[model samples]
Target: MKFTRTANANWKGTGMDGAGTISTQSTTLNKAQLSFKTRFADGVGTNPEELIAAAHSGCFTMQLSFLLSEQGFTPEDLNTEAQVTFEDGTITKIHLKLEASVPGISEQDFQDTATKAKEVCPVSKLLKAAEITLSAVLL
Candidate 1:
């Protein structure tokens, strides 16, 4: 099986004074903003780090759900947050926080499954260069 996704950016001007709009094939993120302020400063725009965080969080959650199913439990809800740390113009680390509710599963089992998900999720593998930390709580 093969899957491909595409996004394009059109930037104008230069450096900190420049800004760009990004659009994806599906238009789910149509004309998202990217700029120096969005990247380095706290600005109301989308940046690469934010996109990576979102992708990681979504991927990890789905992986955990599959893991939970394989462990004979069904997850009721799973909430995840990925904190991508950028410093010195480099991605330093990604901290993942996951809170899950799985019926009929022990806390230890849920935690073990979540840890496994961290190791095997596609996005996690892709971002292996960065330090990946997981905090899982079973509710």
Candidate 2:
């Protein structure tokens, strides 16, 4: 399956002083504000790193669910948190913390499956330049 999704950003003024609003095609983030303060400091609004984290976490969780179903295991819950560390104008690391509840699955199996999902997920592949770490807990 081949498809495309898009999001638009509009910025005004300089990079440090300018502010922008991002709008996705789905309208999930219609005119969401972003600026230097929001990205670097603790300003209110969404930033690129936060958006990456959200995408990574969502993709990984969905991949895990699909893998579990393929392995004849049903997942009750799969919670994943992706932390993207941006330093020196580069993304240095991405850590994925996953807490999952799957029926009829061993700890080792779950770990292996999650690792596979992390390695194969679309966002994970796109961000492969960074060091990606995973901590999976079968709960």
Candidate 3:
């Protein structure tokens, strides 16, 4: 099976003075604004790093659920947070923090699955160039 998605961005003015609107085919993010101040400083708008973090967190949570089900467990809840670090105009690292509640699983097994999820998730594979770290808690 194959899938495709698309997002477009339109910008005006210079880097520090410019502002852009980002739109996705799904329209979930309809013309979200992005600017240098938003990316490099505290400003109102969405940035690429924030978008990546959202994608990674969602993907990782889903992957963990799949792994748990494959291992004969069912997840009651999974809360994942992805932290993207941008330094010197480069994405340097991504940290995944997760709190999960799964029934009928040992802590060690849960941890193993979560680790594998971080290693094998699609987003993790795509962002392999950056340093990725995970801290998972089985609650």
Candidate 4:
């Protein structure tokens, strides 16, 4: 299966002074200059890193949820944060931290399941970073 989104940007001038608008028609961002400053710190709007984080988090969460269900355990909640590190204009590493409120599961089982999810998740496989690490907490 394939997924896609569209973004349009209009830039005026150069460097940080330039601005653009972004729209996804999905309620989050709609035709606004990327230089909004709050989210991107004077970023030109919808930078690659932010988009990568969104994709990684969404993919990891879905994969984890599916694994949990397959293991006969339902997850109360799963919180994931993904950090994409860039060095010299290249993505170096992706750090994924997942905190889950899962019941009736041992720590080892949870770790094993999470490992499987990380390995099988499409995003993880797609990422070409040198390192991808996952730290999962069961509560």
The TM-score values for the models, in the order shown, are 0.96, 0.98, 0.97, 0.81
The C-alpha lDDT values of all candidates are 0.92, 0.94, 0.94, 0.81
Worst 10 residues of 1 by lDDT: 65-74
Write the residue-wise lDDT of candidate 1 on 46-131 in tens digits. Answer: 99999999999999999988888877888999999999999988999999999888888887788789999999999999999999
> Who is ahead in TM-score, 1 or 3?
3
Clashes in model 1: which pairs?
none
Stretches off by above 4 angstroms in model 4 are 1-4, 36-46
Report lDDT (Cα) of residue 48, candidate 3. Answer: 97
> How would you encode candidate 2's per-residue C-alpha lDDT over 12-42 as one tens digit per residue?
9999999999999999999999999999998
Worst 10 residues of 3 by lDDT: 65-74
Query: Which residue runs does candidate 3 get wrong by more than 4 Å?
Result: none
lDDT of 4 at 102: 94
- Rank all candidate structures by their TM-score, best first, as comma-separated numbers: 2, 3, 1, 4
Candidates sorted on lDDT, descending: 3, 2, 1, 4
Candidate 3: clashing pairs of residues = none
Select the stronger candidate by lDDT from 1 and 4.
Answer: 1
* Residue lDDT tens for model 3, 27-69: 9999998999888889888999999999999999999888888
Clashing pairs in 4: 20-33, 34-45
Of models 1 and 4, which has the larger TM-score? 1
TM-score between candidate 1 and the true structure: 0.96
